[model samples]
Target: MKWQRFFLLGSVGLVSICILLSTVRNLVSINTNCPLSRVDKTTLQPTWPKNRVTSSNLSLNRDNKVHVIIFTRWKYGSTFTGEILNNNPDFTYFFEPIRREVYKNRKIHRGVFYQDLIPMLHNTLKCEFIDKNYTWWDEENKSLDCRYSKKLQNSILCEKSTIEKRDISAYLSKESRSRMVEEICRSVQHVAIKTVRVPDLKHLKSIVTDDSLNVKVIQLVRDPRGVYLSRKVTSDVCDMELSECDELKNNLNYWKDPPFWLKGRYMLLRYEDLADDPIEMVHIIYDFLGLPVPETVKSWLRINILKMSSSSKSAYSWRTKITYKTMVTVQRYCMDLLLMAGYKPVNSEKDLTNLKIPSIRKFSYPLMPNITFGVAKPNTV
Candidate 1:
C-alpha cells in the first residue's frame, strides 16, 4: 500500500507539472500585452564575421551585396519580415541601437548619443532602423498633431538641456547618408541593416546642407485605408502617418522631389504587395538590393493566406476590445489621416470587403514559384 501510494503521488506530480508547463506556454504565445515575452528566437547566437571571404583573416572584402535598409511602419509585418530575411543564412541582420534607445528613452539628442554612430554607418551590411521613430513635431505647417501625445509626458527635451544642438535633420546630411549606404552595399558582406522611422524626409532634405548623399531609397507604401484602420485599432500611428510625418509627399511624385532618393534603384515596396506574395515581392527587393535569393525564402512565399488574419481583424476590429474607448479615440485620428492620404473614410465593417491591393510578396508567384530571376546575378561587385 505504501509503494502504491508513492507511485500515485508521483503520477499526480508529473501531471501537475505538465499542466503548469502547458499554461506557461499559452501565456507566452497568446500574450501581446508583453511583447518581449512572446518573441522566441530559435536562432543561436554566433560571433559576427569580421572579414571578407577572400580578404584578410578578419575583415570582409568588397564582394558583399547591397546593405538592405528596412523602411518599415508599425504593425505591417515588419517584425516577421525582418525575421524572414534574417533567417536566410547568407544574410545578416542588425537592429538600430540608437533608435531603440530613443524609443525607450523617448528622445535623443543626435549631437551627443549618435555622434559615435554617424561615422560607423559606412562599409557595413544589413543596417536597419524603425522609420516611425525618426520624426519629431513639425511646427511650420501646423502639422504637429495629437498622434503622439502619450509620449510627451515622459520625454526629456529643451534647446539647451540636450546633447546635440544642430537642426535635427541637418545633422544627417544627404551626401553622408548616401555615402554611408553606398559604402555599406559595396563592402564585401551580405549583412542587412533596417531602420524604421518616419523622419521628416522632406525636412531632412531641406536641412541636408550637403546634396551628395548616395542614399538610394526604397519607399514602402501600405494602403492608407488599412494603415488608418490599423492605427485606429492600436491608437498609435507608425512614423509614416502624414499628420505626424513632416514633409512627407504622397504618391509616386514623392520620389521625384529634390530630396527624394531617385532611381529604379530607389525602389518602392507596398505593404500589401509584401503580404500577398512575400517571397516574390522579396525577390524583387532582393534583386533591387543586389543580393542573391535564399532557399528558405523560396519556401516561405505566399500572399493571399498571409493577409487573411490581419484582414479579418481589420474587418471586425470594432467588435473586439482591448480597450474600446482607446480604440475609438484612435479611430477618430485615423479618419483624419485617411482623408489626408486620399483614402476613403471607412467606419462600417461592410465597406472593407472591397479593397483589392496585394502585398508586394503576393505579386510574385506563390511559394517561391520557379522564376527565371533566381538565376543569380553574376558577382556584381
Candidate 2:
C-alpha cells in the first residue's frame, strides 16, 4: 500500500509541472521586445506601438467583431458617447486623440494592435484637451492630385476665420496627417476623433477605401447658434468670413464621392437633443455602429454638463464641461478646420433653435454628396 501511494504522488507532481510549462508558453511576450520579456511574461507593455514609432499595423477585417469610429465635434456629448460604449469588453473608447492623457503619461493612445484590444479596456479616461493646434488630418499627401494641391483648394481648407484671422500653414503638416490615416485603418476595433473638419475628408478617403471594412462616420452638429455661441463665449476661430456660410457649404459639398471622403460614412448628432436624452441617443448610435448595447453605458443617461469630478459614465460629456482655460484655446486651435468644414456660424434665433432633430439623424445613412441638414430639432422649440 505504501508503494502504491508513492507512485500516485509522483504522477500528480508530473502533471502539475506540465500545466505550468504550457501556461508559460501561451503567455510569452511575442509582439514587442518589451523589457518584461526578460522579467515576466505578464508585465504590460509600457510603450504603445507609436511610442517607438513601430509601423506594424494590426490587421482589420471581417474577423474583427466590433470596431467603432466616432468622427464628431466638441460639445457633441462624447462623454456620454464614451459611457454608452465604454462598458463593452469588446469595444475600446478613444475619446480625443490630441489630449490623450485621459490615461497616464499625458499621451494619447497613438497606435495600438487591434488584437490586443478587448472590451472595458480604457486605463484612465476623461476629456481635458488644451491644444486645438492638434487638428492634424492628412498632411503627408502634399500632391495636389489629392487635396493639398492647388492654392484655391488650400485656401478653402486653411481659410482664416473672420473672428481671428490667422495663417494655417503653421499648423498644417504632412507627418501628423499621415499618422492619422494609418491609425484609423490599422487600429484594432475603434477610432474616434472629435471635431472632424472638411479637409479631413481627404484623409478619411485615402485611409478607409476598403470595401469590406464596416466604418461609420459620426458628425455632431450643434445649433449653429450654439456652436457660434460656444465659439463666441470662448472667442475661438480662425480667419474666416463669419457670414460666408455658402463658401463653407460649397467646400462641404465638394467632398462627396470617391474623391471626397467620409461623406456617406458619417452620422450627424445634434448637441442639444443629446443633452435631453443621453441614453436614447447612444442607443441609436450603437445601432448605427452595429454594436450590442453595453451595460456600462446605462450609467450615463441625463448629464447636461461635463464634470471632471463626475463618474466615468459622463465621459461623453467632456466638451460640455472641461477646464475653463482650455475651453477657448482648444476651440481656437480647431477653428480653421471647423470653418473650412462649413461649421455654420450662429446667426438669428432660427439657427440655434433646433435640438429635437429628425428621426433619420439618429440612424445611419448613405454617404451622399449633397447632404441636407434635414433633421428637425423639435425639443429645442
Candidate 3:
C-alpha cells in the first residue's frame, strides 16, 4: 500500500512539470509571433488594423496599378485638374461621388469631420458603390444624377449596351445596377476620383494609407485671393467670409507638418503653376505616378491650355477685380500659406503680371520618426 502511494505521488509530480513546460513554450511563441516585434521597438501603437491593406499588398495583387484621388477645395480649378486624369484611357474617373449624398442629407456638410467620411471613402476605393450608401437629391424622380450621370456613363469603363437601353426594362433593379457598377470597377486598370467636398487632407488618411488600394493624392491649391474673388464675382455673389478663409489657412498649415503616415504619399500643385504650364505640369504628375503620359492627355492639354491662356492675361486674373480693402484682407488671411507656397503679395495688377510662377520645391520625407529627411522627389514626366 505504501509503495503504491509513493508511485501515485511521483506520477502527479511529472504531470505538473509537463504542464509547466508547455505554458513556457506557448509564451515564447506568442512573443516571437507578435507583428510589432518586426517594427521599430516603440511604445507607439497602431491606430489602424494590422490586416489593413497597404501599398505593398496592392503591388502584389494588381501588378502596381494605381488609385488616384484629386483632392481639392471647392472652385479651385478642380474640374480642369480632374480632366487631366479623365482624358487618360487607362483611368476611370468618378466625379464627386459623395456630392449627391451630401446634398440630400443636410447634416452631411462640406466641412463634415474626417472620421465620418473615412469608412464611406474606404468602401468607395474598394469599388463598393451600393445604393444604400448613397442618397440622391432627386430620389423621387429616380434621377441618375449622382453616379450614373451622362458624363460618368460615357466613361471608358461603362458598358455601351447598358447605357443605350433606356426604357422601362432598361431601368435595372438596384442589385443589378450595383453588380454592373462593381463589374466595371473591377475591370478597370486604375480608378481616379475627384472631389471638391473634402475639407482637409486628414479626411483622406485611411484611403491613402490603405494597402488594398494604391492611392495617391494630388492636392490642388489655388491662391486664396483668386478663390475668394471668384466666389464673390459669381452670380450668387457669396463672399468667402473671414471664417472660411481662416479654415482654409488652417488646413494648409496642417499639411506643412503632415502626419507621419502621409509621408511620400501627398503631392502639392499650385493652380497658378498648372495654369501657366499645364502640359509640363501634367507630365510631371504622370511621371510621379510612373505612368506614361497618354497621347490623349497631351492633346487635351494642348487645346485646353491655349483656351485658358487666351481668356486671361495672367494667372492671377483676380488681382484686377478685387478691391484694395478686400485684397488686404485676403493677403492677411493667407499670409502664411502664400509664403509657404512661394507666392508674393501683389499691391497692384502690374505685380500680378510681373510675378513669376515659382518652381515647386521637391517635398522631402523623413526616413524614420526622427531620422534624416530623404528626398522622394516627384518624377518630371
Candidate 4:
C-alpha cells in the first residue's frame, strides 16, 4: 500500500509540473508575438531614408512614369481641375477613389483613421486594384454594373458584349471586376488621383518617400469664405468649415518645414488662379508633369472654359450668396487659412458685395524657386 501511494503521488506531481511549463511557454509566445513587446522601449526607433528625390534632382520624361496626387478639400474646384488632367489621353485618372473606403469605414471601424487611407492611393498608383478592404464594387451589395465609371467600360469585364450578357443573365464575377479596373490602370503610362479624403500632407510621408514612385503633389487651396458658401449645405456647416480650414492649416505648416523628399516634389495652386486663367494653369501643370500639352487637352479647355463661363457659379459667386453674418462666421473659424491663402476679410455687407474689393490679394505663383508659390501671406507665415 505504501509503495502504491508513493507512485501515485509522484505521477500527480509530474503532471502538474508539465502543465505549469506549458502555460509559461504560451505566455512567452504571446508576449513575443505582441508588436509593442517586440520593440525595446529603451532603444530609439529607426528613421526613414533621408535621400531626397525632388523634381529638380530627378528629371520627368515621357520614358519615366509619374504619379500625380491632387490633394485638396471638398468644394475646392478639385473635380474641375482633375477633369483637366483626365482629358489628357496619356494619363489615366481616378476621381475620388478613396471616397467610398473613407465613407464606409469612418463610423464603424474605430481602427481605421485618416492616415490609413494612404495605402489605397499607393496601391492605385501602382495599379494594384485588389484591396481586401475594397469590396471590388464601388457600391456595396449593389448590382454588378459598369455604369459607375466609363473607364471601366473600356475593360474586358465591362466591354459592351460582356456587359450585355451579364445584364441579361450572368453577373460579373469578383475576379472579372478587379481584372477590369486593373487592366485599365496598367494599360496607362501615367496615373493621377484626386482625393479630398487625405486632409493632411504629412500622411503622405510613406508615399513621397518611396523611391519606386515618382510622385508630384499639387496642394490645391481656395478661399475658406468662398468654400463655405459654395459647399453643399449641411447641418454641420461650421464643423465642416472648421475641418477644411484645419486641413489647409496642416498643409501650410507641413510646407513651411518640409522634409528633404518633399522640397521640390510639391507645388501649390490656388483654385481662383485656375478658374481665372485655366489655359495658362494647364500649360504650367503640363510643364510640371513633363508632358507637352496634347491637342485633345487644348480642345477640352476651349469647349469647357466657355461652358464654365456661362455657368451661374462664376468663380466669385460667393460674393453674392454669402451674407455678412455667414461671412463673419466663416472668417472667425478660418482666420488663419484666410490669412495664409491671402483672402481679404469682409466686415460688412458692403465689403462682401463690392467687386472693387478683390477677395484675393494680388500674389504671384512662381511654380519653381519655392514650394508655396508665394501664396502664403507674409504676416501669417
- Deviation in Å, model 2, residue 347 alpha carbon: 9.8
Per-candidate RMSD, Å: 18.4, 18.8, 16.5, 22.9
Number of the top TM-score candidate: 4
Candidate 1 C-alpha lDDT tens digits along 75-157: 55455556556656665454442353455454666445444344333223333322222222222222221221111112221
> Best to worst by lDDT, what's the order?
4, 3, 1, 2
Provide the overall lDDT of each model, using Cα atoms, as 2-decimal numbers: 0.40, 0.38, 0.60, 0.69
| Over 4 Å off, model 2 | 1-61, 79-83, 98-199, 232-264, 302-381
RMSD of 2: 18.8
Provide the global lDDT of candidate 2 against the true structure: 0.38
TM-score of each prediction: 0.44, 0.39, 0.67, 0.74
Better of 3 and 4 by lDDT: 4
Model 2 agreement with the true structure over 1-381: per-residue lDDT tens digits = 999999999999999999999887766644343421111114311111211211111122244343445444454455445545544444434444433222233242423321122111111111112222223232332221113112222333344456556433325555433333333223335433332322233334433454644455555544333344344444423333243233333334433232334433455555544554444455456645545454434433322223322422232232344443443433444444344343333232332233222211232222223224332222221
Task: Write one digit per residue (lDDT tens) for candidate 4, span 1-381.
Answer: 999999999999999999999999999777654431111224422112112234633364335688999989888888888877777777778877777767667785433476677788888888887644556353244433354334554555544444444332135656556666777877878888888877678788788777888888888888887777776465677887787788788787655666676766777788887776666566667666666667777677656655655432467888888777777888888989887667778878888888878777765543333443432333332
Supply every candidate's count of residue pairs whose N, Cα or C atoms clash at under 3 angstroms. 53, 31, 3, 0
lDDT of 3 by residue, 262-292 (tens): 5555567777767665554665666446566
